[model samples]
Target: MKYLFAILHKLRPLFPQSLVNYGYHFPKAYLAARLYGNPGADLEIIGVTGTDGKTTTSTLIYHILKTARKKVALISTVDAKIGRKNLSTGLHVTSPNPFTLQALLRRMRSQKIRYVVLEVTSHGLDQFRIYPLHPVIAVLTNITHEHLDYHRTMGAYMTAKLRLFKSAKHAVVNKDLPLFGEINARLPKVMFSTYSLHESSQLKPDNIKYFQDHTTFTLGNTFYSIPLTGEYNLYNVLAAISTALLLHVHQSDIKRALMSFKGVKGRLESIENKRGLHTYVDFAHTPGALRAVLTNLRSLKKPAEQLIVIFGAALWVVSLVVYGKRLLSNLIVLKLST
Candidate 1:
């Protein structure tokens, strides 16, 4: 089966996409799940999917659940956590293949974890890499221009994202995006709990303020001041809050979790120094994410200080065209390399 998978991967370009997706990926995932006793079946999973903010949102939800003293695990692009163990899923992989995923779930099951926050990608959903592992709660951060090489069109990409919500008992969505209307129209409205930074939503943050070190926002009468900054992160926080609330976590626990949360690694990570230099390292590869990161950094810089950006591109990722356009407009340092 491994050899056949290798051969199919090599000849993938010649075959029809549907065949590659269903015939190859789906069967492999199905077999792997069966082999592993379908460990995900015993877990209450929270699946977070979108072009960006998936890792941050998933981590936030995991943190909240952990703080609330729920037996929770996490699988994101960053890494996977099972009880006290931290496992590396893979490099540059959002959702692992079925075998790896099933193994992780099995480990989680052994640890008696009751809940899991899994980050889902469009490619993962389309290829059925996480087959038969239905999420109890599905969260859609937002859809944007991403993974066009595999999906070929926005409609197909959206369709892939829609698959996550199909089986979920509840969905927490970002109502600010244009995709919200289509999702609301297609899916049952009662299944949805929404958050928005703009316009009305079930979870909207009022009196929002952004700072270099942290951000403050209000949801109803409760005030939240989180360590993570940027307006983009506010959406992530709200999504996490919505999911936590759905799980029946108290507002006080949520606030405590957010306040103590240091933030996701390699995501707006800050380097502290006494030399009056503000430097951050982030894994913002997408155009939309890049824009948001630079915008946040620019806001923190003084008028006389220049924001130096040393841009690096991964060989497998093709984001240069749109990425370059955004960088050029910023007039910052554009040191490009593959």
Candidate 2:
């Protein structure tokens, strides 16, 4: 990507237009309508977004919805599975083109799928790729600093995420974040529902418990727990469970689905845990993502236990950090507060 950018710089003089210059660019919805028409019109699109856990939540939602025998088209970072057309992440979908997204949604709609769960990223939202699909249920996992360069500031990054709730009829959020109240206050007309550590008195869900083998939680009179570990998964699972119940999937089915879920790839995934010293790893490369994983581990740690953090990055971010070694050290000491 850096090499491509360097080459583009050299050729900038010959070409008189910016690489991404779009003149009166058609909104994704319009392009979607023109090419793929409208698939999300009848199907409920539940958009899941945040710094982390989106893939897990989305997969869980897809499982429960699929278990209930509802057709679903899923577009997540892990993969894009629309009906029988399931493809791996290696497929061309890192920020899908407007027409491609519209076509996918339209395909799902054509298959008579009842639901679609799209994992919306800040970059995808910023690009107006999904402008056509007005989600019925928007699930915001949580927000933290991740895409600072692209967004320029945390505020702009947040604004990109808020675009999900802009058209959603019911927005589900993790109200535990410090920014939750501020974010909710600025949104458009929508019925707000929240999933949190603190159970809402008005909401149906009452007490919740996170267990090693299975997490048992109650909403109204019924108790539910899927076979899963990690406290973060519990919260993310609940977010999906809450959304599923709201969609009126049977409590028994929901319970069954969670119990049987095998889990998603690369999410707090077990790599190699040696004697007492667990070397658990994840695909967390961004500052916010690193913070989220660290926070979860910190919460899970026993008192007096030491938590060691060694930072590294993917190829691109690694280059950035390597090139800006002095800046990185200064920022770590001054700007990053944990």
Candidate 3:
């Protein structure tokens, strides 16, 4: 079957795109689920999807649950944690293929893992790859300009993301995004639990403070501090805290988890050096993400220090001019090489 799929992949461009997706990928998902007895049906699943922040939010949710002494597993773009084992899902893949995904779910079920935080992508949702998994909670970080080439329009792209929320029993969404208004109009208010940084929502932070190495905020009258920097990261933390609270995790456990959780790799990851220089590596692909990352770094750097930026070309045809303009707007005393 692996060879058969490989052969079909080689001939995929020859067939109609819909036929290849619905005909080939659909059957693969169904077969994998049937073979694995649809393990997800018996598990408490949280599906996290958006243009960004999925990994951090999912991992944080898993961390809070695990810290609260719950048997939880996490499958993010960074890695998958099943009990004590850390397994690589794949290179450059968010949600694994149907076979690997279902197999992981089966393993989690056998181990009595009650909760699974799975980071899903728009492509994974649209392709019917995760067709058999029904999430109890769906999380949308935010939707911005991305992946328009495949979906052809922003409306189509947004619709693909909505599919996950439609399958979920409850949804946690970012209320600050304009997309939130659309989501609110479509889904029932009872199904939504919102979090926001600048607007009134169910979960809004207060008394926010930003530092070079960490951030402090107040949620639900309890002050929380995280070893992560950036306002965007505040949203990620809020998302996790909201989900953890929904699962009945204690606020004290959530505070401890937020303090201990270092962060995900390549998502504003700091590299230690002996030279007393601040260096970071991040997985910022879009202009909005680039702006957020740079904005945080600029706040941390000294006025006299030169901020150096080095980035490469994107694999897809993004508006390089817009990216460049965003980068330039954040540059003060800076050196840029692309």
The collision pairs in model 3 are none
- C-alpha lDDT score of every prediction, in listed order: 0.88, 0.70, 0.86
Give the per-residue lDDT digits (tens) of candidate 1, residues 52-168: 899999999999999999999999998999888889999979999999999999999998999999999998999998899889899999998776767777888899998999889
Judging by lDDT, tell me the better candidate of 1 and 3.
1
For all the candidates, what are their Cα RMSDs to the real structure?
3.1, 5.6, 3.1
lDDT of 2 at 210: 49
lDDT of 2 by residue, 126-166 (tens): 76767767888988888876666567678988988888889
Task: Report the candidate with higher TM-score, 2 versus 3.
Answer: 3
TM-score of each: 0.92, 0.77, 0.92
> For this target, which candidate reaches the highest lDDT against the unseen true structure?
1
Which tens-of-lDDT digit does each residue in 171-268 have in candidate 3?
99999998788888877643888999889999998899999999998876798889999999999999998898888899999999999998988998
Q: Rank the candidates by lDDT, best first.
A: 1, 3, 2
TM-score of 1: 0.92
